[model samples]
Target: MNLTQLNMLSDAQLAARVAQDIPDGSYVNLGIGKPTHVSAYVPEGREVIYHSENGILGVGPTPPPGQEDLELIDASKRYITLAPGAAFFEHTDSFAMMRGGHIDIAVLGAYQVAENGDLANWATLDETYPPAVGGAMDLVVGVPTIFVMMKHVNRDGTPKLLERCTYPLTGLGVVSRVYTDLAVLDVVPQGFRLVELTPGNGFEAVQAATGAKILT
Candidate 1:
C-alpha cells in the first residue's frame, strides 16, 4: 500500500497490526499517542504485561463504558481494566522501572527517524503547541527494544523515515523496529530492513516513498 492507502486503515486495524508484532510474555510500555491502542488488540491469552508510567503494571483491556474509575487510568489517561496480577505504586517507583531497564519492549510514536536509528518524536519547531517529552527518554534508553509506530509520510508528503532526522533528537541509535501503515522494518546495523509489507504494497513503491534505503 502507498501512503494514501495506509491512511485509510481504521484506528482499530492499525492497532491490530501492531499487536501482531508483540511477543508473548513481553513487558511493554505503550507511549501516549497511538501506541496506547496496542493493548486493546493483543491476542487473547497471550500473557503480555502492559505497563503504565503512572505506576500500574499488567494492565488489561479498556474498561466498560460506565465502569471507568477516575483514579485508575493508563498513561494516556484512558480508562482501563487491570489484569489478574496487576499492581499500582508510586510514580517514583514507576520511573525506576523504566529507567532501571526492567521493560522488555517499548512501543512509541515518532515524528522522524534517521537511517542510523536516531529518533525525534516529541516536538516540532512550531511554537503553537507546547511539546512534552514525558517518559519517552527513559523508555528509549532503558528498554532493550524500542518499536516506533507511525505514519510513513508527513502532512506535506515529507517522508518521516529519513536519511537524517530534521527534528530534535530523542534517542540515538536506539530504535529496534518500525511498524508503519505500509510495512514493518527492522533497524539493523546496515539500516532499516524490510520485513513485511501490507497487502497492496510493493518493495519499490515503499522505497520510492521513504527517504531511508530498505534492504532487499
Candidate 2:
C-alpha cells in the first residue's frame, strides 16, 4: 500500500506483516514503541523467543486488565504477561544478553536512517526537544541484525531515509534494514537496496520519498 494507506492497517495487521519475516527460532529483542507490536504478530506454532531489556525472556503479551503484576514490566515499562519458561533478572544480566551477542535480531524504531546504514533516532538539534539515547547503542552493537521501523518521511515531507542524516546519529553504521510505510530497504555494500515495496506503492514514489539512490 501507499504510505498514507499503510495507516489503515490495524495494529494487529501491522504485527502480522512483521511476523512473516521472523525466522522460526529467532531470539529477538523488540525495541520500545512500534517494534513492540511484533510480539503480537509472531506466528502461532513458531518457537520464536522474545527478550525484553527489563529482564524478561519469552514475554507473552500485554496482560488483561486487573491481571497485571505491578512488579513485572517490559522494557517499555508496560505490564506484560509472561510466556512459558519466561525468566526475569537484573538489568545487568539484561545488558549482558544484549552486549554479549546473545540476541539474533533486534527490531527498533528510528527517526532517521541514512543510506549507508547510519541511525539517528536518539536526538535532534531542536533546542526545545530534549535528547535521550536509551539502550539503542547497546542494541545496535550487540545484535547481529538491526531492523528499523518508522515512517519514510518527516512531518514536513522531508525524507527520513536519506543520503545523509541531518539529525545527530545514534550509531555510525549499524542499521541493516528499514521497514517504512512505503517500503523495506536493505543496507548493503553498494548502499541501500529496495527490497520490498508496499502493495500499492511504486518504486519511483518510494525513491522520491527517500533522498538516496535505491538499488532495485
Candidate 3:
C-alpha cells in the first residue's frame, strides 16, 4: 500500500502521542526538531522535568508572542520559556547531566532506525546535509529509555525504519520505542514490534511502508 493513501498523524498529533507515554516525574531530554514539540503536549497532572543540552534543566513550552527571551534558547536555538525551578549551568555540566545517567528518558528525532534499535539521526550519506552528532551519542548511552519520534517514510516515500541504517549510527540497540506519523512501534530483541497504528491506518499498510519486517 502507498503511504500517501493512509491518513497519517500530523506532527503535533504525533508529538502528543509521544507525550502521553512519558511517565510522570520523568527527567527527559528532548532532541532537536520534531522531538522538541513533545514538551508542549505533556499530559495534565504529569510533571516532566525537561533537560536541554545547552544547559537548562527545566525547559518549558514556547513563549507566547511578544514574550520571547532571546538569550534563553535550547540547543536547537529555538526560543523557549523556563519552567518553575529551572536551573542553568555550564555547557559541560549540562552534558554531565545527560552522560551521567541523570536523565530518565530521551525523545529524539531520527533519520533511520534499524530493526535492532540502531539509531542514525546524526549524519546521512547525503552530501548536502552536514553531519552533526551533537549530544545524541551521550543521551542514548546514558538515558534509560529512548523514544524516537519521526516520520515513517522519507520525502521520496522511502522507509526510514529499516533493516539496517544506511547512515552513520548515533547508538546501537538503544531505542526503546518509536512514535511515527503512521504508527507506534517498539524495538525488541527480534525486531520492530507493533504497538499501535494511527487512526484509520492498517497494520498491513504500515508494514508495507516500513523497510523492515514489523512483527505483530
Candidate 4:
C-alpha cells in the first residue's frame, strides 16, 4: 500500500466512512462536533433521516459558507439545511422521539471510552472546565445503537480508550462501535474488539496507542 494510505483519515473522510456504515432507511442523530459531518456524506439513494434535538427531523447537509441560515442550526449551533420532507416540532417532542426509542442510531463525540463500552464525553475530571453534557445523557439512554467518533489518543499523546473511564461517564455500556482515526473497534462482551485497522497499520501499533487491552 502507498505510504499515504497509512495516514490517519481526515475529519471529512472519517465522516464518509461512518456514513457508509449506516444502513438505508434509518433515523440517525449526529452528535455535536465531528459527528455532525456524517450527514453530508450519506450514500447516494439511501433514505436515512437526520434528527436534531432543537426540533427538526429529516435534516440535510451543511450549507455552503455563504448560504448558511442563521435560524436553522444544530445542537452545536452549526448551520444546516433541511431535507425535502423534513418536519419540525417542539423541543420536548424531539426528546420524546429520542426517549421513546424512535431513533435507530446516534453518532456521538467522546472524550474517552471504556473497554466495556462506557462513554465519557461531557467533561474531564478537571474542575477547570465546566460540564456541558446537553442532550448527550438523553441520547445515549434513548438511542438503541450508539456509535462514538473520536481520536485514538488525547492531544497530550495519551490514549483516550481506557480500561475504565477516568472522566465522568455519560452512559454505561452504551456504545456499540467506535470510529477513531486509527481504527474501527467494536465493543464486545470481552472488551474492545479489533474490527479493522487503518491501511498500513498493524495490531501492535494500535495496541501501543490504546490504553485498554484489545481483545484480538
Please report the candidate that would top TM-score against the real structure.
Answer: 3
- For candidate 3, the per-residue lDDT at 103 reads 93
- How well is each residue in 123-154 modelled by candidate 4, as lDDT tens digits? 88889877787999999999999999998887
Question: TM-score of the candidate numbered 3?
Answer: 0.95
- Order of candidate numbers by lDDT, starting with the best: 3, 4, 1, 2
TM-score of each: 0.93, 0.92, 0.95, 0.93
Stretches of candidate 4 off by over 4 Å are 1-6, 64-68
Better of 2 and 4 by lDDT: 4
lDDT of each: 0.86, 0.83, 0.91, 0.89
Stretches off by above 4 angstroms in model 2 are 1-12
Prediction 2 global C-alpha lDDT: 0.83
Q: Candidate 4 vs. truth: CA RMSD?
A: 2.9
> Model 4 residue 163 lDDT?
96
Please say which candidate is ahead in TM-score: 2 or 4. 4
Q: Residue 184 error for model 2, in Å?
A: 1.0
Taking all chains together, the TM-score of candidate 2 against the true structure is: 0.92
Deviation in angstroms for 5 in model 1?
A: 7.2
RMSD of each: 2.0, 2.3, 1.4, 2.9
- Please give, for residues 41-117, the per-residue lDDT of candidate 2 as tens digits: 77788888899988888888788899999988888889988888888888999999998999999998888898888
